[model samples]
Target: MLKKITLIFISLAIILTSLEAGTSKRKGTAGAEELRIPVGSRGVALGGGVVAEANGVDALFWNPAGASFVNKSAEAMFSHVSFIADLKVNYLAVIANFGGVGVFGLSLKSLDFGQIPLTTVDAPDGTGETFSPNYLTAALSYSRRMTDRIYVGANFKLISERILRESAVGFAVDIGLQYRLESGLRFGAVMKNVGGNMRFDGPDLEWGVVIPGSEPGAPVRSLRVPLQEFELPAAFELGFAYNLKVGEAHSLTLAGSFQNNNFTLDEYKGGLEYSFNNMLFLRLGYSYVNEADYIFNSPSFGVGLNIPLGGTLEASVEYTYRKVKFFNNNQFLTVRVAM
Candidate 1:
């Protein structure tokens, strides 16, 4: 299983790199549209520190390779995000261990736009009501420990989006690797959203150029043009984390990650998390990245609780909050269960 997963990711990496070879290597554009795809709530909280400490289903989003470290028989997680007005994002994931073979995970992320007032040029004359645009992503993931200190994983994803009445669909993949070093330090890398382009195939497609008048008896010819396809917001993230055991009951973790955004440019995020015997966790994180208009520099806070339920049951809840310039506060709530 590990060998197959590695081979698949290797091939995918080569293919994605080839497609992006000629494009301008410029980073964030004026309106970095695809940057809005929030990576993960837990990471967003700890400023994405999970790359090193990741475990359980959260690993599917942070660093799938970490899923191999999960000791639970089964694990599940669900998260909801109040990102902005009319925009809500939600995610659910589950991971199960298969004896001594490896671990498997399934995850889904959906962005919902509440109903909006549909308007047209003919407006009051009214054509039809506006429909909210929504996007969905479903992925299957696998993680394994090829060796004692090396871990790897891969994800196959299905993506679909609908705007008003038009829709488009595509597929993508994610690959990640993590290695632990001495002194409680960890290093990791991941490539995300690598895939082919998608074309909008909804209604309203017209044939041939509509000209006022060409000739007295000239017949208009139908012209077919290739669909306009957009590039995926592909990116690479490299991170490092170190944990300091202050005492028997207290520990502090500091982590930083650099993101090489394919569509945008680059970003830096740093954070710190403190834990009390793994029972209580408090995290503070900050991110810095240039934006077209306003710099999306913000700080995040999170709190977590780990409760042991009898024999094989475990429960946890995490809440994160971040303040973005010119936007309402972003809130994320996630619940996790293990057996």
Candidate 2:
């Protein structure tokens, strides 16, 4: 079973790689970009290099395959991100594991753009009105431990975006695989945002126009301009992680990942984490792109504390900070509970 599962994932990786080839010309062309935003403090703090090690509810946004590895029967997570450009992101996820069946998860991520001044072509200066953009993604995920060393998972996502009176709805899927070795080495691969193009439609696209050659008293015709569809920002990522024990109460983890984006430059990420007695964690990570135009070029740092609330219940708090270029730095706060 493990062999067959591995083969299937490898085939998918090959197909996705082929599809991503020669896509550089489409840079900055994909829509539904909110899908690319990172959530979960731990994963973001690791520069998104935790694909191989992510577990529990955190894996819902990083690599679903790891979700089945949670030690608890159920888990829940909440996170808030202070993104660049005054954007705010809120994320919530819950997962339940059924022995011998699988792990099922549900997650929601919403972007808060706040309020913006509404203006039309005729009122370019001030319209005295305000509108807020709404972007949300709701996902249902399933994950299973195919074998002692192999895990597989997938997520089905519903995406919605609304701007003023215009809105777009789309769907996507994410598939992931994780393999672990007894030596504390792990490998992960994921294909994310596989879906159809999205096109916006609503009353905002309709306008009244008068024919140029029409005579006097000509009636104005209503025209609804058709909008072009934009492809989703798809990506394929491969990652590796290794854990080393330094003593009875100390350990270290090293993680790295390579990401191929269909609508942007490729990225390489690396992260280091230290843990003491499985209670406290410190992490540092960095990301590199071939070009210098990427906004998040600086290092990321984070810390986490795990507390046992009682029998069979545990709680965790995590915080991360990421430096961005030419913008306010990003920060994430996450709380998690397991029982």
Candidate 1, 1-339: lDDT as tens digits:
447545754664565455442223454331214334564556788776556667668888877888887778899999988886647889989989985688999998887788777777678655566577778888899998777767888888888887765678888888888776557888677787778877776554546664577776677777654567876777777677888999899999888887766666467788898999888989999887765543458899989888999898989988889887777888889899999
Q: What is candidate 2's local distance difference test score?
A: 0.91
lDDT of 2 by residue, 88-138 (tens): 999999999997899999999999998899888899986999989999999
Which regions of candidate 1 fall more than 4 Å away from where they truly are?
A: 1-36, 124-128, 207-226, 290-295
Residue pairs with backbone overlap in model 1: 27-264, 27-265, 28-264, 28-265, 43-48, 118-130
Model 2: lDDT of residue 65: 95
Best by lDDT: 2
**Which prediction has the highest TM-score against the true structure?**
2
